[model samples]
Target chain A: MNTSKTQKHRADLLVSCVHDRAPDLIPALEAEVKRRGLEGEVKVVEAGCRGFCSMGPVLLIQPDGTFYVNVQPADVPEMVEETLVKGRVVERMTYQEPSSHACALYEDISFYSKQHRIVLRNCGMLNPASVEEYIAVGGYEAVGKALFDMTPEGVIEEVKKAGLRGRGGAGFAAARKWETGRKAEGDIKYVLANGDEGDPNCFMDRALMEADPHSILEGMIIGAYAMDAHQGYIYIPYEHTLSVKTMRNAIESARAYGLIGEDILGSGFDFEVEVRVGAHSFVGGESTALMHAIEGTVSEPRPKHIHTTEVGLWGKPTCLNNVKTWNLVPEIIGKGAEWFASIGTEKSTGTQVFSLAGKINNVGLAEVPMGTTIRELIFDVGGGIPNGREFKAIQIGGPSGGAVPASLLDMPMDYETLEEAGSMMGTGGVVVLDDRSCVIDVARYFLDFLKDQSCGKCSSCREGIRYMLEMLTNITEGKGKMSDLEVLERMGKSVKISSMCGLGKSVPNPVLSTLRHFRDEYVAHIEDHKCPAGVCKALIEHYINDQCNGCGLCLRKCPQDAITGEKKELHTIDAEKCIQCGVCFDVCRFDAVGVR
Target chain B: MPKLKSLDELKKLREQLQGDIKARTDSSTTITVGMGTCGIAAGARETMHAILAELESRGMDTHVTTVGCIGMCSKEPLVDIQQGDEPRVTYGNVNTEMVPRMIEEHLVQGNMVDEWVVGRVEG
Candidate 1:
């Protein structure tokens, strides 16, 4: 055996090293160590993409849960000199504030104090690229326990007892699907990981897959074992590079370790995993359309006659769950049903991961126990709205989800509650809105996205979405009739009822939700022919206030030279030439710009 | 390839690990470098390397290891130090240049570097 290998094996420090997004720092740091003669004392390792994207570069100190932030190239010396040399700490750079002093712990930072990470537990802990690191942290031990210790029926019972419903918006009980798949009359059953997360501002599933690929793999393997499925496929988006690479490496590593492909853990069950990447069409995220795309056909949905559990993917008993749902399986099994059931609300066990973005002080991924109030997510975890802006509305669940007005901030964030609030918990993308955001414009943006993404297989989806888009466009453009509201509601219902897939079924969410919560915004646009938030260009005009010294910056920067004013005087916009471009508004730094 | 049949067998594995780690006990200084994915992405690798190198160069018996992210990615290259009942100090935005002084002043002399410590957590 190699002496270096022996030394490595003997190293007493249990280090799970991860550099959030900039993995290139590993080799460079390793080089710095060797150049300075600190080679054998430290072991350098590379890992996965931690889910926190907004904070770009971060590192976590373990065992005692010390966290540090905003680390740059220059601070390394002070860190090493103070902490490592004399066995004392350099308090200034710590993640946790000196308790007896003014600084705060990482948890006290309002951004993280409210989060309850479950699906994302290993994201920033273990190296995503290493199978061994995953194993050391009890990654595949669940598969071992499930395959040998428990019967398939026992596994299903445990999951049922755990109350782990699907996290991918549907909230279907995961164990029941397995039970149904197991009961279906078929020689071959299939397990599929639905990685088609095409929602706007939704990155939780992708982040989970990218950060902890093996956990997902282990979960899928366990699921396959429970359902007697021999093959699994991960239908990921073609554009998701990090998740694809991580998942592929994980699958290969599992195969090599005899954890997959043939008689895993010496149990007489075999499973193989495959990957299928799809294009940018949002319709492909729908189950039937995704299956059609997988079957070498154009992505389109078929009516639900034979359930996927009964016959799917070229006429076989198939079971498909989203990436987040698959990611939760190992945790449920490893921690035991009761422990898993202990988290979150009674109806919604465990935590739900959300991509917290838009106008918030902290924009990143957050995992809070289910039934966490939107107020807590936005105010406490998101650090409130940026620039002290008043909280306006929060659009939950992407384009097919509804908007929650500030009045409902105390509403719990779960499938049933959000649905009652006119929003489905579709993938947990909460885009926090500030007072500056126009509710009508926000609805319009989601409508535009849905309109372009509709597969056009059903007449209601195609025609209805197109009509809704036209009406919303007309409303925003100050050309809508009062009767347009009636048309929009009628078309939205037709699309919801006659749609072939979830994509079409939920397409009217933004419009319906906005109408429910902020019908005033739509009325303002239609009746007054004005945008309340002054966001829609056709309804608003921009002008520099008299406070402007006519710096000439605004005049010169105007696209069409709309500003007509002499130097050292307030500028006036020529309404004829203005085009309401708002260039003059943006260029004035003296708080002279006003949009009306 | 066999399941742990009895408690005795599990106990043996524990004993083997204990014997392997006998030399390292009562480590005076515990320095943890954040190596979570976000931390790693944020240049944690460099911070970790510099910390270890500085420790070895100063001949300090500090135990340097990697840990997971505490979910603050805005500040990467995190370092946590615990020494002799002194409050645990955390350093953020760590890089190579800060390592030597951190090792010399903080680890060796037990003098806290006020400029480098960004936070502290209670035991």
Candidate 2:
């Protein structure tokens, strides 16, 4: 370290460094620091995901807790010179609130302020690759406490009193499953950590695994000890290579530290963990299918007549929990059950991590209490919809989950409440939709997704999903009858009841929920042969309004050359040749293009 | 590092590690400079160097670090001085000339340069 000739420097400058996809800003920052000869005076450290991905590459200065967004390489010199050398803040780089016009600090920004980060407490705060950093923040204290202070029975009872449910999708009580696994008559028992997150547009598990790998390991160890499981498996999808690598490293580090492997912490408890990578299949995330895959068999779901807690992973008692669910165990043990139960609603205790994305200003991961309203998640924390668009609906859960209309925005976001509102809190993926989004089109999109992912174990799921897709496609293409609605409702209900696993059962949620909320849009498409949102291609027609200044930008973009007219005059679309592609509507600067 | 043998050992290690991190990051008086794109364009680099040189000569243990932009683009080159748990005082349109006075008043004498303060971070 080059000593600063004047005095020994102590302050460290931390930057939000990006290695994948986004441009790496660390090189420029380092170059500027060196050019100024302030290497030893100011230490530059790279931190992990700052949660505000949209505004990245972000930079946060610690000790004072100042945050900057949308940083470019060219700006590094001035930042280094002024902030590092002179201790003066760059006013332009400071965050200015859109509404209040006040310069917002890191803690004051609504995106960071509105969050209740229980699961994501360590994320974006520490260097994820360093286990020492994790330990410094009180990481494995729970595992130590569980080993020394709490008995196996005591741990289970505390979790039961905490009311922590499975965060994966089903919302089943975690302690209940552990008790079943403990009581089952088996010579060998196993604890399986479900990192196989296959939900569309959901990445809370991926973020948790990447940011804090040891949390999951600590939780698994506690769960393994509580259930008397000697062996464990962490099953992650192949697509999540980062999570898999991080988990593997964490396990090895824990072993080296004697926190895992035989006689952990001198407690005489023997538990070994192995990482299992699986193909990215939507149905593979199902409990039984995951167990089969782990046992080196074809990944397929069997009938759930017998619970996995009794018979799982090659005919042995197994306790399977989601990654987020396992991450919560350590916290519940560290902080007592009553403390955990005090948060969230009466039934749903602890916070839920939601991947808030689509049609929102701030798109990233958010962890809020169970009772946090949809309005708070979308408006307050999300910074509302971008470009001042009105929020139409929010799709909670993944593609298999339902969409709730804006009218029910105040509904509390808990497992039971969301289920009652025609949506399950499956994997905590809240996708917001705006007014321009078509309800029928949204239902068709999810149906198409489910139809492709459906495993052909049960005819009800395989054929039922296909039939529903065909019906939704017909409605969008202006080829639907009034009686098709009744058929769709009947088919959806049957599929929900007769499907073998969670994947097939909840497949019709998108269709059912959209149909229940936006039936008028369906009625308009079928009865009047018109798409209300002007989304369905076959049912809608494009026309040039009087507002057209005849820019000819649309004429150049039209593939079929359906538009006609000279420059600087109102253009016309020939009805016979027009494809109704809506390219003109998107390209028009003066709002000249109209769809009906 | 040796393996933490017991719960008491683990707890003691955590306390020592936290203390080291807290000493560097959570000192009584911390000065943060906003060094986002807008701040650099406004010549915040000169202001920063001036403050650092002043602190070095004075031999004060005051903590100073550079932070990303806080989105106040119109007011480029901002400085925030926070002492202990009190509200953070933000000074805007900061330059090299303002650095010595601000450090002397805020860091040495424990008095804020009132006119230069643009905003205060309230709890």
Candidate 3:
């Protein structure tokens, strides 16, 4: 009566999110598993980031999909007994929804359920360092498929069908670049993977580079195969040491497996790849500037009279792609182009990995389909703004990219839609802004950033951005004329049109978009000399209201001894001494601190 | 780490390694054999090897492991099978020859062998 035995699988206790906080659990889990005599039955895999950064040191038991958050070495024994050995979930270890107070599994969690991970598919599933594990999860098969199964033109056609675009915010068609490189007359063409991410809060590229490095290599190999290019360079900022290290390791592993070197998969295709570290700059992610850096020159953009796809990297046809774009290549090839195109919108196909930062409740990485509205990305996937504050704006794209106001929350996040809204999907970095965030101040922040980063190749970028920054600064300090707004818009537009590279072209997006959408906020500052958000120091004054119960917390926190009050009575802020620091506003439990 | 020569070779390797990483995926069935000295002396090691090879040939992905004896010396080589949310079924006096049918009836068919199964425990 006995039936056939099933192919035996191993149970893996994945110590997910193996970053700075993982060393303790990683070592303890391995040693404890061995000591408990469960090594054969259970495997301790140190996985990459699960994208839920705040709730990490997470543990996931595979074959059962039981996820435990905030696990520590001290809890390892009980976890090993109650979950690993006993074959059940430790209910207390699961993640609880902040509002609902309800516990849910990883798949059912709102944060994860809303996300459709394509680029991040392998990020937390396996040990990134192990090529065997990568292969086990269907890695590097794309190279075989690309080189053996499809011709170069066939591959390009497939990508065109997929409608893959540049994810570094430019939104250029990836297949168009590859086709140009393939058709261009060159014997020494190159494929470049741009990991030199420069957005203020964007780490999606770095995360992809660090977490699943083999995927990057796999994608690059496929790119090289498609473009008829042999040499490749992964240009990462020097500061991303972990990403650099993992990429190098992944390259070596792929090379050893003959996935990267000559005659890959026994086909006649010969390709090799290496890592290139450059001086970190916001402009470094731009295709032209990245090529200049790779050529051992100062990292600055060159005019695109002749495209890089035709002549680049020492006068050879070169194709450069963002790390996220390169990461998606393998997935597209492995799963057909039609499958990828089916996910996102018609024009913008495939999913985008958006790094949710700034004032959001869930400050993590989310890969959602392209057609997902900004509302879904911010509220459904990103868990909305923190502390029940009203959403004022979201700075999407990057420093050079524009901010969308709460009015456009329903705007679908595709290249065309975001661009039409005066924003670029700058590598999918979404910085949420609450009511407290000043649009003028936010624009000033980006202008200040661009002033330092712009290469000065175009006078419009150098002078235009500097003047834009000064005007925004003056406006924030309650010193703007109505005439200044017109000049600012004209200059922002000139910089957008005149700049040679991506840096200057899109540099003034923040100011222009804010002026376009939140013009009343600027008028509030210019005419009334008041910062509605109470941020500009020169325009606002702080005082304690009658609601103050004299907690004395603000008195202790005030650096200038501006606050003085009795322990049980309403406190007062000395107007002469108050520097408008707003420390009292942050510290007071009661709604006592008022800005006027 | 010799380079794979062709697509077929890579495909073969993928198919082979898929089994190795199955435990790392969403495989819910687990097969545990008693590997204590008494069990090993009763040819449990051979039975375990037979089960592994059989599973590979059958392309069935499940978790296979070994545990210490529970003092049932006479009923040596006790093999326990547990599927997802299913009660663990223990088969007594299991040998190499009994593995194929145990896999068929218990794992593939989802039924306990009437005469062979000695005990059961909560999943």
- Please tell me how candidate 3 rates in CAPRI terms: acceptable
- Lowest lDDT 10-residue stretch of candidate 1 chain A: A1-10
By lDDT, is 1 or 2 better? 2
RMSD of each: 8.8, 5.7, 5.2
Q: Write the per-residue lDDT of candidate 1 for residues A78-124, one digit (tens) a residue.
A: 54433333223446655432122323244456556668877887776
Q: After superposing candidate 3, which stretches have Cα over 4 Å from the reference?
A: A1-10, B27-59, B63-103, B110-123
i-RMS, each model, one decimal: 11.6, 8.3, 7.4
TM-score of every candidate: 0.80, 0.86, 0.89
lDDT of 2 by residue, A1-596 (tens): 12122223445455553656345478788788889887765656666566676777777765555677777787787776666654566677876665555453578888888899888877777666767667767888898888889999999999999999999988999999999998999889999999988888888888788878888999999999999998999999888888888899888888877778988877888889999998878898899999989888888999878988999999899999999999999999998999999999999999998998889988888888999999999988888998777899999899888999999999999999989888999989888889777888988898888887888889999999889999999999999999999899988999999888888889999988988988888899999999877889999899999999999999999988999989999999999999888888889899899998
Using lDDT as the yardstick, the better of models 1 and 3 is 3
* Span of ten consecutive residues with least summed lDDT in model 2 chain B: B17-26
Candidate 2 residue runs with Cα over 4 Å from true position:
A1-17, A88-104, B19-123
* TM-score head-to-head 1 vs 2, winner: 2
Best-fitting candidate, measured by lDDT? 3
Fnat for every candidate: 0.01, 0.25, 0.46
Candidate ranking under TM-score, highest first, comes to 3, 2, 1
Residues B24-100, model 2: lDDT tens digits: 34456666777777887897766777877787677555666667677898887988887877898999999999898
Question: Model 2: chain B TM-score vs. truth?
Answer: 0.75
DockQ of each: 0.05, 0.19, 0.26
| CAPRI grade of model 1 | incorrect
